[model samples]
Target: MSERHVTFDMIVQAVGAVAGITHHEIMVAGRAGADERVHLRYACWWLASKMTSLGPSAVGRLSGGRDHTMVIHGQRRAEELRATSESFRLSTDALLGTLQALERAGLLRFAVTIDPLATARRVLSAPEREAVRVSTYEIVAMSRLIVEQADGDPSEPSTEETAHAA
Candidate 1:
């Protein structure tokens, strides 16, 4: 049988199925609070990190364009929850066991090369897309600020912006 490699997309879908949530729910970055979906997101992060060779940054990008630090924090939170919550531990263990069994059966392999922006465009809702757009703008603004500082000319706009404005 051809080995079906696991991707972050698959992991998110699996976690959503296991948690009785929709993939959209899993992918959405909702407001931080006592939402149960947050735990599910953390679980997805933990599972993707453990099951794949992707680093925190890669996982973060694939998951939701989140920062690597947030991924790391989610991983730590998953560990803490596993230690303290028996139900959470059991659920995670069951999911891990299922994936391991698939690996052994040659049904699935843990390898992926994902394009974060492409995945974001495919999976993100309008609001999420807007968030990514704003992030891109912020990065451009920071770059312009750095260039201005280096050139010692705060009044001058970037050449690219000037060209666009013309």
Candidate 2:
């Protein structure tokens, strides 16, 4: 009804566009919880969608009135859990693939960075995507990164650690 309300609705739509969960579902899931800032709220919607259309009650309780952080933590935990569990990883890859499709459909942008227009072709190329799938390094890396970002903690990679991984 109000301009502020419209802006909030758009955020929900954008998140729904990316997660395919819809604004109505997010509203219902949220229950009576704190807003928890913008990015965190988006994370909440995504986790709620992932957990069997589960309402926002679980997430709300965990967030400590910080639904946004709760969302980030929940997704982070989901990703961490996904790493050692084959079925979980498969489920995630499937969900992410579907979400990426929606993003590619103009609902949102994946923003695959590139060196040049010529090099950009490789970003979405099947061979390139397949090349990156050398086991399950992504979920682990991403969850850690998200946790670090949300917690304001830097992910300091020691030179030895980097060299070892390399």
Candidate 3:
């Protein structure tokens, strides 16, 4: 396999890790097509475009075969959000930190400013951190429910199961 392929994979992993979603979710637009998902997708495109030799069209192709216009629009929107929204800026910074961590771990060859710890500390105030934690928990719980439903296992845990669960 080519180094580029590996780098692309790393990029995808980094995005998923920072966004708190699975790689599958990153690839799929999702049922709700929520703004959060769209933003993350845009972030993916922006990061790939910035870091790789690939043009907008190529980056678009990599990100769910989106058109070049979509790539341009998404990147532009993300850039605008970063300029205007503090939370969005922090989130993007956090993502950059993850990418940098990937680079440090030798999962990626490119150089990125890895300051996720510091940036997280600086950006996420106490209440914000708690919110993020709660949000993550909720997302995980919801994802689990979705998976169980998809598998045709909608039965709730019985008292016996709960009793032995702990």
Pairs of colliding residues, candidate 2: 40-68
Q: Lowest summed-lDDT stretch of 10 residues in model 1?
A: 140-149
Instruction: Please provide TM-scores, in order, for all candidate models, with all chains considered together.
Output: 0.63, 0.28, 0.55
Note the residue pairs that clash in candidate 3. Answer: none
* Best lDDT among the predictions, by candidate number: 1
For 66-96, candidate 2 gives per-residue lDDT tens digits of: 4655565656665665666686566446645
* Per-residue accuracy of model 3 over 6-91 as CA lDDT, tens digit each: 24445666777877776557666656767878877777777776555577887665565689899899889989988998988887
Error of 2 at 25 (Å): 8.5
Q: Which candidate comes out best when scored by TM-score?
A: 1
| lDDT over C-alpha atoms for residue 3 of model 3 | 32
lDDT of all predictions: 0.70, 0.43, 0.62
The order by descending TM-score is 1, 3, 2
Total clashing pairs for each candidate: 0, 1, 0
Query: What would the per-residue lDDT of candidate 1 be over residues 1-166, giving only the tens digit for each residue?
Result: 1433666666776887887665555656657543688888888889877777778998876665789999999999999999999999999888877876776777863454445345445445565454444345334434533453353344467788789999
